[model samples]
Target: MSVRMLSRFRAITHYMKLPDDYEDSQGLQFRKEDLNQREVNQIFGGAHLPAPMANKLLRILHGRRVAGTLNDPNLQVNTAQFSASDQRKALAYLRANIPVDEVINAGLRAEDELKLLEREEDGEQKPVETSPQDLPPDTATNEIPIPTGRLPRRRESDSPYGVSPLDRIRAHNIAKREAEEKRLEEERKKREEEEALGNIGTLQTQQEKPKKLSPMMQKMVERATSDLKEPPEMKAWERLLPQAIMTVLIFAGCAAYAIVYTPPKRSERLWPDIPPAAATCLALVGINLTVWVSWRLPPLWALLNRYFIVVAATPRPFQLIGAIFSHQNFSHAMLNMVGLWFFGTRLHDEIGRGNFLAIYFASGALGFMSSLARLVLTDGLIYTTLGASGAVYGVIAAFFWLHRYDEFKLLGYPPDPMSGPQGLAFIGLILGLHILPLFSKKAHNIDIPSHLGGILAGVVGADLVKKHMDERARVRAERLKTMGTLEGVVQVKEKGPEKAPQTAAGR
Candidate 1:
């Protein structure tokens, strides 16, 4: 038999508490005593059993046995009378069967053998009789007498079995169920008590009213609230600096042109009849120059709306793009240009030049569309509005979208506690400020709808480009994987199997 089978057989015999003489059909006796350290090691190819198992097996072998049983076949008959050489041979066999350490450590002596025999004799001793009264009350009564009745008296707690086995089981089950229910009830009460305490604390806090703001604090709050309104006019130079520089440069260019190529006398127009492309180019230069001069010269703002204005008599699609480069005042142009410079440079770097231009133009177009839609919905006369505010607002939207996690402080707000989401919230608040006036008893002249339209356009454009790039990358990865698989298949086919030669006779 295999060593594993032998070990399993020994374990089964030990567990079943079978007699040593018990034999199978093959007459192979499983003597418990034979499952010693040496024999156990041999069964497992001399591998070391864990110390606990080895110790357990040792205890089992040493334990008392049934009386009058024959000597176990595993025990050597002349072990007690063995010579030195015989003992050495036996020890060697034992070591070879079991782990060397187990064989060396195992000290089986004549005294232990005699003790086993004595234990066996003691285990076989007959038990003395005891009185029923000496036992515990529960175990004392082996049976109960039934009362005489035509139908067995139906006791309250008894079933047909007289002892009411069902009643006992039912009582135990009911007790367990009641205990579980009680535990759940206790937990529920504890949670309710905690919640009640919390609510009481909150109520008490509310009852104790907060102190009113101090007179000084009240005054400060009033000042803060008033500060939100439009501020007083700036200095004369601060207002006209932007327009002054722009006017000087414009007249200088016009004068230079006139000097270089004087126009025919009696020309009806003071301005040259420039081509459409040159006109557009001149318009851009004028807009940029106006913005720059506005930053340096503030007084020229008064005449900007009258002199530098170009009104679109009929609303055209390109007017949206054109409007962004148009200005009503030096202040407006300067402010718009400042916004663009601050946000546009970084945005251009992030999305690249092509994408930036697309986003800017598309957002401005959307803003114009919003304005046109508003005009149609209101049935109001189409009014000319000009500024780079819509396009600049688009750049701001793109900035927020790309760097949503970047933090910045709102003007006149607490500094250290600021965050990106909070700054965006402030922007939303300002937009609401513009929108709320529409419902009030005031002229809602500002083009609030166009700003919102531009912001929405910018957000959508950036997201679309991002998603497109991601999809392109994913497609490229899938193509590479396919190519690799194809290459591997081709290589396998290229290295075809070599053929065996056939004999001449077979051929």
Candidate 2:
């Protein structure tokens, strides 16, 4: 036969559940002593099984006998001695079935063993009858009357001495239930007496007038009542005024310092000649840096980092612009500020405040997007890039376009101080910094592509601004010519003749 067919046959035959009439079967008739002896023999014989395993098998066999006897109390068969072969068969059957529910089977086994032991002890201490010679003459002549209703009968498997444990357990439960019922009944009677007293007390309270409050309490009650009146609701502006004032003060302070306070290079001057728009932008950067300092607190840092840093892995479009205003440390903030002061003032002078601001944001955005795209392609999600380096590079590009970078040294390096190659060399130097970290383990974080992206954006933006300046100027001049007082309405005729439409309504 095939292995599969053999397994199926074993599963059908040996795997059957305990028989329904197992209580009447001779297999479940073994005494506790016999089962224990067999278990000890198995362990001592150096059987190739764990001690606990043999013990568990014995317990399961005992439990099976107890579980079977649940319905048939009178079932009995001689089981004082078991053969080695029968013990082996019983152990195999237990191993197959008992593991299905070890806890429950073990419990049943223990309970049955305890009961059998108690029964055996009681049987051994059976009551002895006195002889006629030993008894008193009067006691010997008297006879004890037996109950007529029933006679005590012993089952084949019952103990030879005291009453069965099942009968004793039933009696104990009946006594306990009676005690609990009595306690509940007494409580009910006490509750009835209390309820009667409560009714009398309530009636007396209804007949009596309420006691007056003390003088001090009356005054306190009046004050409390008076204080409970609703206060007048605040206007929207009144409610928001403090927050608005604080915000304005913060921005105003930063702006005043940026405009009036001369930069380090022009420290000798009383005030720097910074334009209003550029000053405002610098002030906003200052506010962003102030918030950045509070980032030492983990929760705030996480919030700011997510909103401000250009996270290449989890890129958010808004962060592209916000990141240009963010700085990691004080040194980082100072370096960006120096860059801005050097190039920003010059760019503002050349293209006007509005155009400068537009180019600055556009270039920074393009630079962040470039870095984000490259990181995504490289699968560098954990990589992060921040600071205004992209915008600073954009300013540098604009400065180079308008003047010359030959005289200026970028980060203390200028290969050619007065040549066209200087600009290209400076760009190349920056790119080298970005690439150095990849090759050398000692080098720090550098985002070379962002600088290049900004420079390219700056060039394109500058060209566009220059091209549109004339058209923008002409439109501004026309708006000024049509300016009028708000109190007086002014109408103007079209310079060109109006053309009639070739439609049915015109006809």
Best by TM-score: 2
Cα lDDT of model 2 by residue, 1-507, tens digit: 656433322211111133223322233322333335456555446454444444544543444443433223232222224445545665565556534343333344344446556766887542242222233446665753311111111232355685566765575466446545766888677767656666333444553455687887666445433242342344434423443354334334433442344334444433368555467457746765775675554445545666688765455556775687887788877877788777787777776655676677766776776676666667566578887878878877766655434545656554555333455566566556656666776745667678777887777767666766667689888777666542234322332234433354578
lDDT of 2: 0.55
Kindly provide the TM-score of model 1 when superposed on the true structure, using C-alpha atoms: 0.34
What's the lDDT for residue 248 in model 2? Answer: 38
Residue-level lDDT tens digits of model 1 in 1-507? 655445543422111122223221112222345455665565444444643344333323322111111133333221333344433433354334432222111212122345545755888432232223223455466542221101111133334555455755574466446545766898678767756766333454554555588786666445433232332344434423343354334334433442344224435433457432233334444666555455343344423333332222234334455566666467766777667766777776665544566666666666655665565446443355666666668777876776555666657455555533544664576467657876788765567777887787677767765675577679899999999999999988766443223344457
Clashes of each: 14, 0
- Tell me the TM-score of each prediction against the true structure: 0.34, 0.36
Candidate 1, residue 324: CA error in Å? Answer: 1.8
Q: What is the lDDT of residue 495 in candidate 1?
A: 63
lDDT of 2 at 382: 57
Alpha-carbon error at 176 in model 1, in Å? 96
Off by over 4 Å in 1: 1-287, 290-313, 405-427, 476-507
